[model samples]
Target: MKIKSYFQFTNEQRRGVLSLLLLIVIIQLSYFYWSSSKSTSPSNSNKSWLAMQSVIDSLKISQSSSEGKIYPFNPNFITDYKGYQLGMSLTEINKLFEFRKQNKYVNSALEFQQVTGVSDSLLLAISPYFKFPDWVNQPKKAFSSFDKNTYENKKSIIRKDINEATQDDLIKIYGIGPALSERILKQKDVLGGFVTMEQMESIWGLSPEVIENLNKYFQVTTIPTVNKIDINNLSVKELAKFPYFNYTIAKEIVTYRSMNNGIHSIEDLTKIKGMPNEKIKIIALYLEF
Candidate 1:
């Protein structure tokens, strides 16, 4: 049996096939024309795409701003991690660490930059946060433990424990009166107890002559109880709480401690920048290692 050929189709059937092909072609052309000449995009899709881009840009800006956040802190205490956060390079950080290791101090913005060799822009950016101790802000009369005059008086001078002295007992001293005597007691109370003869010098409104007379008679025996700071755990604020050390000295002490493993002896404290050696002996009396 032979298969029938396409020429066997009737004209009606052929016209039907052509009509079907024409209809399909027309439908595809109309679909393409409408798709290519669209009226507008859906508002939601356009808005959503734009909104996603905006969110991504906002996150990028937030990340950049976060990098600029700088908390106020004492520059002297910057550890390697803290230095890194402040945008310091390893060499700059190491230079700062080296300067501190010498038992030295950075007292100004200029000095900080000099020690660290930080960029001028970075120094300016961070300079406002540089905090030195109050003493660095306003220096006091220079003191020295090696001063020969500190021990100039005769050995025969009478001395009494500052805490044991009564108002009348204090009055017997050449320059002390009832008011002054009370002031001394109050100071002693506030300080726990006098740990050094030099502490009398801190009494308010006392003339130098009067201070000398009082010093001739008064001395420190019993140290009032105090919570000594662990040099290893010291902060500038904590070290300043001691009656013997002021804010400036406290910062120096802590900075020195950080550079070194920790303060090991009174002698170590003397090495701190501008530490009064005479006071250090008295200060040492109250502090543990």
Candidate 2:
């Protein structure tokens, strides 16, 4: 009986010991799992930091390449370097805005130069940065042909017939001002059309040089026949038929011719009190004695 009891007590103690061992093994496994989970959490954090660092490095590289591409040929960048040397004051530089408005680049820098006398080297420095618009170099070719045609037509009219020519035709010729055109029309009304090129010089205020310049562009082919009248017998109305001889001048001419017993020669015209040698010379080409 004693032996059985001792064996029973030993069996019970062994079972208790096995239970404590099992508890200790479970505690160790839990500790290992917790420690491995803590270690893996730190490793995940480290990997995340590495990934973030890679992303930041990629962004830095991209920024560097972008800056490299835009460094050259930037107009603003070029202007910044050149504007300092241009010597343009704030007010003068402001004038560029006005010039930009009208698109007039030819006179853009002229006013600035007048004010500051900016050096030529400085002007050259800024010249490249200031882009003259493409249209300035490529002016409208639309008027080119029209201008050429007008120039040719003007030359043709000056050398052509004058009696049949209209006012439009007369204006095309050189040396014909508005006053001269009126004078020509008045002379045509009094003595018909021009019979000789020399008659143009007889117009009021016309100089000899003007007549000489115009002679190259004109010619005379026809002369109108004037009825031979005895100057002494001529009435004021008949004497007024002469070109530039107004009613007052006609009365004077008729009175003088009557007093002088009818003018017969070109020298007789000079004998009249009001008729000067210069005046007779101008009218001689149109008159028939």
Give the winner by TM-score. Answer: 1
Backbone N/Cα/C clashes per model:
0, 0
| lDDT scores in order | 0.76, 0.59
Using lDDT, give the best candidate's number: 1
Error of 2 at 231 (Å): 3.1
lDDT tens readout by residue for model 2, 155-249:
77546545655666555445566656666667765666677776776665444545665666656656554333445566789767665566777
Give lDDT tens digits, candidate 1, residues 149-263.
6566555566888778888887776555667788888877756677767777666545566677777787776666744556657678877776667899888887888789788
Model 1: how far residue 132 lies from native, Å? 32
Assess the local accuracy of residue 283 in candidate 1 as a C-alpha lDDT between 0 and 100.
Answer: 67
Task: Give RMSD (Å) of candidate 1 vs. truth.
Answer: 14.0
